[model samples]
Target: MKKASLYGTGALLFLALTGCAQQSKSDAAAQLNDQSVMALNWFQQSGEYQALTYQAFTTATYAFDKAQSLTGKPKAVIVDLDETMIDNSAYSAWQVKANKPFEDKSWSRWTHAEQANAVPGAVSFAQYVDSHGGIMFYVSNRDQKDYAATLANLQRLGFPNVNAKTLRLSTTTSNKQARFDAIKNEGYNVVLYVGDNLNDFGAATYHKSNAERRNFVNSNHSLFGTQFIVLPNPLYGDWESGLAPGYNKLTPEQKLKVRADALKAWDGK
Candidate 1:
């Protein structure tokens, strides 16, 4: 009887340990899933917006530093307002929550709709630039028709010293070179160009492959940290385009395959 009781107790202990181990694994998986959901939610919501505002602060300081170094003094820091100076989180969230993909038509409608708010630190930075006699030019890719709403949004956000004419959109020009040229023609030494997209610098030249993009950055690494401050926008950008060009071209299975292949490459086995 003693031997039987001892064996039974041992069996019970083993079962309990096994159950505990399974519970622990289940708990770990649940935690991982929760974290992933939160991360996705952040990207869909305010992550980029928050990043842009912080980048704006960095850009302001960097440009100010460059201006301080110049001989005759740098004149202006050209800024792109959409992703660079405004928080478009609500719109992003709306899209994700509604299961709507990011399409240009939808994006254009969003841009024209005037729903984006001023990014954190953007208003303060712009005000600082104005106070320091630094000209702020809004060289955005937003359509010309969006000028009115864009201006109104900026004004509503209390961005100081902004004239309606200072905001420019692509009409005749295919790229930002023309706008940069215009600034140069106006006889103001442009100290910096702040934006979240590659096109904001010079669209035609910068929107190629990953190698070309990296080369561009390498060629201008000196200016990157100081003059050309980049704001983060992981949810949408050239990077996403590089990863998955036009979702219409790829079926769900194809996308999964591409993602799997990418992971395999990372695994090196």
Candidate 2:
């Protein structure tokens, strides 16, 4: 690379990191409050968020209506945490601008008890599900260590009927099918499932490859606006699978090579 070009890239990188640091400082000062409601507002302001919100709402509403029509068994909705219920966009945005990989320690420090907030209409929809004899089961991959804090955050945000037991954390099982099956065995008919990731609704091993994942999504397109509700999460999820799933197995240099390979594979055809 030319000296001038390298200097420019370095300068831009510095500026980006500085901007993220400033945002983090502000977040720290604010005591990591819930911003999901505000994020929803921002989503509404964006053409993309607007369309996604509409699709998600339609799916939830349809599920609710179907639940109301059911006679004997009760209806339930399996919801994911993170981007589905809580808005961690700020964390993601910070990571992108800073050009840093996601660090759990840093992320945990940032998303203290006050950081989690409800997505737009999340609280309202959850409450509705509760009121209409629908059980809202939060099936999240978040570690069990964050359980109490997660519950506290959800409760603080007016997310109704959220209990510690209802949360199936990462401690439960590698496959979410176990969780869903547990729910089914408990007598609640799961009519709707919501998440920002594919594995949230389906089996965990569905997205090992890009082709298999796309096929899964297409095959289940019938559920797109019905039982399967997927919220938009561009910052991560299966998209990051291209970079390789397990980073611990690889050295830093190996990780970089895998990332380079992923980029190459993406651009190849």
Per-candidate count of clashing residue pairs (backbone under 3 Å): 0, 1
Off by over 4 Å in 2: 1-47, 67-71, 96-99, 172-174, 204-207, 243-269
Tell me how far the alpha carbon of residue 96 in candidate 1 is from the true structure, in angstroms, after superposition.
1.4
TM-score each candidate: 0.72, 0.72
So what's the TM-score on candidate 2? 0.72
lDDT for model 2, on a 0 to 1 scale?
0.72
RMSD of 1: 12.6
In the range 1-269, model 1's lDDT, one tens digit per residue, is 99999999999999999999878655543442333345456644666756656766866676665565345654787888866788676666656555455567877787777788776777887887778778788887777776787787788888876676588877875478888888878877787788777767776444475557777778878777577777666545565444544633664445445545544345456
Candidate 2 weakest lDDT stretch, 10 residues: 28-37
Q: Which one wins on lDDT? A: 2
lDDT of 2 by residue, 177-251 (tens): 888888889888788888888888878445466667777778777877688888887556665564476744554
Deviation in Å, model 2, residue 127 alpha carbon: 1.5
In angstroms, the error of model 1 at 125 is 1.0
> Candidate 1, TM-score vs. the true structure?
0.72
